[model samples]
Target: MTTFDNLLLDLDTASGILTITLNRPTKLNALNSATISDIHGAMQQALDDEQVRGIIMTGSGEKAFVAGADIAELAGLNEISGRRFAEQGQDAFALIEESTKPVIAAVNGFALGGGAELAMACHLRVASENARFGQPEVNLGLIPGYGGTQRLAQLVGKGKALEMMLTGDPIKADEALRLGLVNHVVPQAELLGFCQLLLMRILSKAPLAVGLVIDCVNAFYDPERHGYQTEANSFSRCCGSDDFREGTSAFLDKRPAAFTGN
Candidate 1:
């Protein structure tokens, strides 16, 4: 467990849970430059750490997981800085979206604007019953720059995405789950335990195979390229990974595979 200046990072080896909490509860965990950088660095830290099998992202405070970008800070930036700002956010969250290890967003409360986009970036999402999610940047005369426009439709279907983004209305946890925007909705008291159980199941598989499926599935949605090649390459590559060998042996021996994600 470690604390980066403004972020609380707790690494639990027993469950291989690397939880990153956006720590700016005072500002409702707004995404300032420092916060974004800390999040980017924290994600990279988890990705590079072999000990971490999965990641869970959240925020401090009971009222909000994250409200949005720090509009106050951005309101004064020049054009280039503005471009850089959006790009930085896009890059950071893109890393989270494409991580080999599964990352889950435990949305405890509000997840609006970029915050909602952040949840969209994760591989899966679980929300506390009290949570409310939306991409309400349109209300401020803005668009979701961090893959929200793209990911939202993929998450909740085009009709739901259009309704949510076009109206800028927040959706509750049950609604989110029903619309397929999130996987599970649990009481706040049980959210962590429920999410951990899901993560444990994923970690029980061969990590490389999981990564392979992730890459293949993500490739399926990329507009620029055909997914056949991507899935084919991943399928072929997995044949030689160390995890594949262990998985095969384990299947034959009727025992669980011990995969190192190689």
Candidate 2:
């Protein structure tokens, strides 16, 4: 229930879903230092709350999920300050990528530049039919500073990422899906509802196992990280849990399992 100047937090305790909406519609919910700081805080709040099992991030207004970074703020950055700002945004986004609970980006409209980077940081992205995505930092004579270069390539392959970054052209929802940039494309009215249903389905499973799966899958992309080892370790950890016992017993009894996330 923390108050934020640039964001709105809605926690559905019964469903264990926390929806964080980016405010500042006048600028298309552009990223600034204040907004980035608020997002980091909001994510920490969700992680600390036992009632929060998942998160959905979107923009307040229908015009944009987030158009890009605040150009006014970026125009003032020098070399030293620009690196610092990029690092700060990266730290904030790393929280989203590494969270124990699932985070879904409900892209309701434009997700350009840093906005696109923010969506990429989430575990999954579900875009509305009207959503547009791009890494158009080149248009401003700069590059994507908030992990967009790396993540964009990772998500949509190097060739497509290079095409988008170099051209600074925006892609609509269908193109984004074809490029594997988004998980689902739904009507704008159905975006939030669809994300909530997906989260609830995830929450119905064992929480510990779910967290481990996220860790293992993310490790797959790290050069120094051994994904197989991580998977083995997580599997062994899950084997020792009480939920494992209940899940097996219920299967044998031909009944639905009631997992307590142990």
Can you write out model 2's per-residue Cα lDDT over 1-262, one digit (the tens) per residue? 8889999999888898989999998999999999999999999888998988999999988889999999999999999999999999999999999897999999999999999999999999999999999999999999999899999999999999999999999999999999999999999999999999998999899999999999998999879999999999999999999999999999999999999989
- Candidate 2 local distance difference test against the native: 0.95
Worst 10 residues of 1 by lDDT: 1-10
- Stretches of candidate 1 off by over 4 Å are 1-3
lDDT string for model 1 (1-262, tens) is 3457779988898888888888998889988888888889899889888889899898897778899988898677777887888889999998998898999998889998889999999999999989999998888777887789999999888988999899999989999999898999999888777888898899888888888788888888888867999888888899989998898999999987888878
TM-score of each: 0.94, 0.98
lDDT of 1: 0.87
Which candidate leads in TM-score?
Answer: 2
